[model samples]
Target: MQRRDIAEMLLLAALWGASFLFMRVGATDFGPAALVFLRVAGASLLLLPLLAWRGEVGALRAQWRPIALVGVVNTALPFALYMVALLVLSAGLASIFNATAPLWGALIAWAWLGDRPTPLRGLGLALGFAGVLWLGIDNASLRAGSAGVSPALGIAACIAATACYGWTANYTKQRLTGVPPMAVAAGSQAFAALATLPAALWWWPATLPGPTAWAGAAALALACTGLAYLLYFRLIARVGPAKTIAVTFLIPAFAVLWGAMFLGERLTPTMLGGCAVILLGTALATGLLRTRRSRPAGSPAP
Candidate 1:
């Protein structure tokens, strides 16, 4: 990859990694439903105008069913689950757990799409899951020694959210391959906003969020959801799905950095190790580390 492309990939990683921190902060005042609702709704409002400007509004109207399904599985469900998980889990830990999405995606593809995972990929999945199990056990140990809610449950929620993401990724690849990524992003968010509206209303807090919470929500919607999707689609277009989705590997690192810098959260050793393992597993699953020995260096290998 060119240096510019690498830089863009890193930037994408930073943006997505920061999303976990934004969710954690926003979830303080808003319930999971409200937080997710605002995230999708805010992004939808911003993107709708741009979509209209690009003459893509009809794209949404045309593929309403697939778009709506994508919204439910990809945005609404996983978003809410991550937020709920954040209520108990550290942002860093939750982000690391969410990195397991590709592993789950591989398994889903094997079962649902008849795509066979190679041996190395299978081993990568096992290692990734083992890391998750280790993290869960570590969280449980910490919680047992404290007087608060069990962190293991939080990790579990994040893992479940990643599974949903995994399933959605394959679903989109198989079902909506030809749709423009922007249309997919915008339509899904709009559908998610609509789907979450009732829940948001029901669980709406008694009072409005303070300035900080509002700021966090705005950032989540505008930066994380809106701008992030633009970058995501750009990467997806430049690279194929496997390479583009590899951005998730860097998210935990960025999440930890953001949490430390903004939230004053500690960078635990366990968190670092977990992040490394997850990233390694993701790399293996994506075949980023595998090289063709049959081809000479500095030459393209098939």
Candidate 2:
């Protein structure tokens, strides 16, 4: 990767890492459904114009079906779930859950596409789930019902969101290959906005949230979803998915940093240990480490 590309990758990680912070701040006031709606709605407003500028708006019509599916699975649903999770979990903890996406994606690919995971990748998946369970149980007591959403529900929401992310990554690769990344980004956001608009209206707060929450939502929309996709697609073009996706490993660190400094969230021992295990597993799952492969797979991952 070029120097500039590396910088962009780092920036992308920072932007995405901060998303948990935004969600943590905003989800309480905005509610999960409304906050996710605003996120995708706001991002669509920003990304679609850039898509138009790139003359890729036309691609949306051709790819509308898969794009819409991607929007629902990848953006709308997961965003809502994670925002719900953020309502209870610390930004740093939620961010650690975010790192599990690749692990779930790999398993989904294995099951859905008949893409066999080698022993190393399987071990990674095992490790990732182990960490997630440990972290979840340690961070929050699993009980039948609590006054508000239980910490355990929050944990389940986060894991399920990552599972949705995983499934959709495979769905997109199978259904929308060769579509311009910008079009995918913009179109998905637009469709997500449309999909979730009704839920957002129904769930909208009777009383408006404070300025900080509003600002957090705006930053989550424009900077994290909007600008971050632009950087993400550019790096994918320059460095390939293997290198660009490596940013996943770095995001939790920045989330931990930002949460500690800004949100006054502390890193507990379980959080640290679980995060380390999850990232190590993600590295293996994402092919950051050398893993055994079969010949039918065509070639080993980079």
Candidate 3:
């Protein structure tokens, strides 16, 4: 990849990492449902205009059903669940769980798409889940219910969110072939806004949140959700999917850093250990760290 592309990839990772910090700050005031609604709505407002400018708004009407399903699974539901998890766990911990999405995706694809896993991939999946269980075992808040929910429950919510993301990856691959990324991005956000609106309204805060909370929510929407998607798609176009997806590895470190610097969230040793194990498993599962392909004995050397 070009240096510019590499820089853009880092920027995307940073933006997404900051999203956990943003949600950590804003979800308390806005409530998870409302915060998520604003995020999807704000992203839709940003992207829909660009789509209209590109004369791609028609794509929404043509593929509304799948797009709506994508919105709910990919954006609205997972986002809200993460916000709920953030209420109980640190941003860094939550981001570590987020990084496990690829592992979950592999399993989901195996079940739903008949993509059988190699022995190595199966081991990676087991390792990833072990890391998750390690974190859950390490956290006492899960049993204490200090955050009004057990930390274990928070972990479960995060796992559920990643599971949704896994389903989303496979669903988009199977059903949305030949669709443009920008069109899917815009249309899905638009429908996510609609899908989450009712719940957002239902659980809306009785009192208005302060300006800081509002700003955090807005940043989560525009910078993290909206612009991050644009940059990510651009990176994929410039650097192929395998290279572009490496950004996921950078995100949790950035999340831990941002949370420490901005929110005074401390890094526990267990969390760090879990992060390391999870990333290792993720790397193996995603084929980012694969063994060389062995040619058949009769095959000629290239």
Candidate 4:
């Protein structure tokens, strides 16, 4: 990848990493539904204009069903789940759970798409899930955090959110295949906004949030959701999806750092170890890490 692509990838990771921090800050004031609604709504405002400029509105219109499904499955539901998790779990811990999506995606593809995993990938799936269970066993306690919610509930929510993401990945591959990325991004955000609007209104905070909370929520929408998607698709175009997806590995580190720095959240040894194990498993599961076999001297380059 070019230096510019590398920079963009890092920026994308950082933006996404900060999303946890933003949600942790804003979810309390705005409530999960309202915060998520604002996020997708704001992201739509940012992306829809660009979609129109690129003349991709027709693509979105034609593919509205699948794209709307993606909006609910991918953007709306998982996002709100993450917000709920953030209420109880630290940004770093929640991001570690988020990293397990690829492992679930690989498993889902194997079952749903009949795309069987290689032996190495199968091992990866096992190892990645083991790491997840390890983290959950250690951290998913019945003890409630300051939010009066149990960490176990938070952990379960994170896992459910990742499952939603896992499902969306295969669904998009199967169903949304020829749709323009911009259309999918913009349309999904718009539909997510629509889907969550009633919940947002119903659960809207009784009092207005302060400026800091508003700023965090707005940044979460505009920068993390909107700009991050643009950067993600750009990196995919330039460096290919395999390389662009490496941003997932970097996100936990940034999330940990940001959580520690801004929120004064402590990083436990267990969390770090779990993060490492999860990333390693994800790498192998996603074929970012692969085993090579020796070929015969005269073998064809098959």
lDDT of 1 by residue, 204-254 (tens): 988999998998899899988898888788877787665777788788889
lDDT of candidates 1 onward, in order: 0.82, 0.89, 0.88, 0.92
Tens-digit per-residue lDDT, 1-302, candidate 2 = 78998889889999999999888878878888899999999999999989999998889989999999999999999998888778778889998999999999999999999998878778888888889988987977665333277788888998999999999999998988999999899999999999999999999999998887888899999999999999999888888897888899889998999999998999999899999999888877666876445333667556
Every model's TM-score: 0.92, 0.93, 0.94, 0.96
Go through the candidates in order and give the C-alpha RMSD of each one to the true structure: 2.7, 2.7, 2.7, 2.3
lDDT string for model 3 (12-83, tens) is 999999999998888888889899999999999999998889887777778878988999899989998998
Report the backbone clash tally of model 1. Answer: 0
lDDT of 2 at 60: 90
Q: Clashing residue pairs, candidate 2?
A: none
User: C-alpha displacement of 197 in model 4, angstroms?
Assistant: 0.5
Task: Residues 200-239, candidate 4: write the lDDT tens digits.
Answer: 9999999999998899889999999999999999888788
Question: Which residue runs of candidate 1 sit more than 4 Å off their true CA positions?
Answer: 141-149, 291-302
Query: Of the candidates shown, which would achieve the greatest TM-score relative to the real structure?
Result: 4
Write down the TM-score for model 2. 0.93
RMSD of 1: 2.7
